[model samples]
Target chain A: MTALIAGAASTTFGKHDDLSARELFRDAAEAAIGLVSLTAVDIDAVYVGNFMGALTDDQGHMGALMADYLGIPDVPTATVESACASSGTAVSRAVDAIDAGQADVVLVGGVEMMYATGIAVITDALANAADNEYENEAGLTFPGIYALMAREYMNTYDVSEEDLAQVAVKNRRNGVSNPISQFQEEVTIEEVLEARPIAPPLGLFDCCPITDGASALIVVSPEFAANHGLSPDVRIAGRGQAGDTLALQDREDMGRTRAAERAAERAYTAAGIVPEDIDVCEVHDCFTIAELLAVESLGLCERGEGATLTTTGETAKEGRIPVNTSGGLIAKGHPVGATGVAQLVEIVKQLEGRHPNQVPDSAIGVTHNVGGSGASAVVHVLEVAG
Target chain B: MTASWYESFAAAVDREEPQYRRCAACGESGLPPRQTCPTCGEPEMIDAPLSMSATVVAATEIHVTTPKFEGEAPYTVVIAEFDENVRLTGQLSGNEDVRPGDGVTVGVERREDWPPVITFTPS
Candidate 1:
């Protein structure tokens, strides 16, 4: 039993001062269900991915609330939380329910509203993802954590700041074509280098902006899609999730994300596909340096060469192996929980040839979502169903 | 609320000598006390004074910090490994130049309103 995506939609990833996380989720879910031409009666269950709703919105039991808001209060509901990979984790669960014949169709998505609060609150909330006692207590935030990795990577690979700035420049360029992207303007290498340092060796442009958005995916078993006379254009080819030590100091290597490596390997084996088989990919570019590490950890490039790839334009939208054509979290805005589901939406659009910046002949795609400094990771492979 | 692992480190730091925990059964040495040995299912652990000097394996200068760390922005944080397996994180005493593999000495530092924290300085 394979799960196929029937429909996908996402709200623009940016500040939504007027909407709460629930309202954003509602908008995305309604639009997504509309895409499939489904009613509340069609959804059997709802899985909501949320990272900090409790802290930010003071809301929990989101599963029931979301289902109720969708006018399907009786449906079984569960809220998945894995920090940044919350929605990605939710997608995996939805796929499991359908694959095991437990459900025919499921509404799986992620939502986060961070603009209601200030950066101070959001930073503290995000810090909960790291080791509260060891890492966060040491006054390290996400930017500082990734900055550590960037520094080590630079020293190990003999890479320079300009090499990393290329990633920021490339993703921003891709974001220009994405109407839903938070930052549609492109940046230059010099500008990135000159940007105010958020964490030394990592400037303002190196980090993903705080965002508020929601994304939803309607997944159904192949039979369900067929019974409804709907074409299953995209199929879940492979899925994998892995975990690692929460604290970077506990890990032996900070240069690589072990969880991503493990997840990508499992996903590739399950899909019977290699890196070369992937035509397009949307990786977790939560940080510019993260983009570099993600490519290497996914085996899309060699270790210590991720920066080189960025510098040579290999990971650009027009490069040899296009990555993050949706502008990624860098320019796409990371709503944390919604990022995973949003990644899949971009991949599906590319495969359907409906993406604004289409990767020519993109048939196979991969999405990598990481939670909290690579402590957890989920990898999914998607392909055109023909 | 003080975490179990922080007890030994915090206590030692207050005494002006930093310490790390070693699982008595498996001989795994690190900081931030664990109730049980991660490598071996042993609950017995011992605290020992860590080597005053260590090597910085990773370092970063955080320009923006969390609310708890307000006014401490632009501080340098480093992960230093001591006695081969014992690794810990601390803020450098000053905006000193620190690099991977740079030798440093660990100690304790107290800020006006914050709790005692581990501090590292170039050895």
Candidate 2:
């Protein structure tokens, strides 16, 4: 509760052959530190959010690596990984340190370089987030995991493929304006439907691409901000993180995301704001069905009403509540560890009224980030501090 | 890995018997065995054998496969809610057109150098 976001920055989400993982973090880290006019020495600790560095990037011990790379090698540091929610959890940890009176300023950054791993190798690596002995061994993939939910969703509800395709249409339209987004060009629902199937009900267009990007945020104690004569309008109002069963077969209702619902409930109570109070939002749309599940879990709409909400154009930027204004993970790019921090970046931008696709008079925003198959979900509510 | 919990389930998979854990305390059934009952944290769970009959709950024909499944591309995966009230996710055996609510029989394909693959046949 005492943490205030001093600075935020991110590398463009997509292919990056020029920079290593540590280098990517450096760029974002230096920029974020510079945003509030501080050197690395001012940061009391470093929290790095990274996943799959050892398997794909041949780099492990990310905390020490990123800290040493940023010329702050001696600070206490740790690498946090909850699959894709790594950075989101990392940010939460930094805030906790501030609330616990451990540190004045903490540097949190998330980075992943997956584009170099290629499809075959990366596909298997990403599935490590699932239950490897059962789910992966049984041929279940990340897309397949989401596809299973999509199937149950369709069979139980009066939904069709066309209904899910609307998510891509709206997000792709939003991506066209986000320079950091991976897929800038828009695609029609016809293109979404006609696209080759990855898993039934989810096509190549429905899934998030393998991305290489990084995001960084400088979190400070209220006293530190005052001592430095820096007043931040954006503060983390409330945050909630929860877990669910790792595999899909274990879930009682495949249609619902229990972790997100629980996490959002805790966050809403913490922030003292309801879903209706949210002006702009960003969610982990790892798959099109994921966005629907997220909105329902976050209470944006009723259960089983996400697809209908999209069909009504209420989730679009110009609609009642602008969701995924940063193109979401579907279009913005999901660099696993960086996604949570990246979602926070988008939310902060909207709260600052400086977003590339800014909404009118937006003072409150929320970010929903979930790891593989809803096993890990973290929701944070950011508000403009007076 | 206290894999003793999984040994019975693995043995059942190897023998192709339909078995799942039932909490001795609460009678809740679970698959992909765990050390304790997920519902009540009961340590005494018995592996109740089943008749292998099941119904299709959901199915997806996967075109994009992982590195392991890449060699065996384009296979249908099914979540079958067995008659015993436990669900198993596996590949559809022989694929004779299955939709939700269709009756099916559970099977396991075990081979050397590969993990056990759960399969379902429409009945």
Using Cα atoms, each model's DockQ against the true complex is: 0.71, 0.72
Q: Please tell me which predicted candidate would have the highest TM-score against the true structure.
A: 2
lDDT of 1 by residue, A38-106 (tens): 797889999999999898899998889999998999999999999999999999999999988889889
Interface DockQ of candidate 2: 0.72
Worst 10 residues of 1 chain B by lDDT: B1-10
Candidate 1 runs further than 4 Å off: B23-26, B35-48, B111-113
Error of 1 at A134 (Å): 0.7
Candidates in order have lDDT scores of: 0.89, 0.88
TM-score of each: 0.96, 0.97
lDDT at residue A132 of model 1 (Cα atoms) = 81
TM-score of chain A of each: 0.99, 0.99
Point out where model 2 deviates above 4 Å: B1-10, B14-16
Tens-place lDDT digits, model 2, residues A1-386: 74799898888999998889988989889988888878999999899898899988888889899999889899999999999889999989998899999999999989999998897887888898998766776788888889999999887788889999999989989999998999999999999999999998999999989999999999999999999998987999999999998888888799889999999999999999999999988998999999999999999998999999999999999999889999998888889889899888888888888899999899999999898889999999999978
Interface RMSD of each: 1.3, 1.3
RMSD of 2: 1.6
Measured by lDDT, the strongest candidate is 1
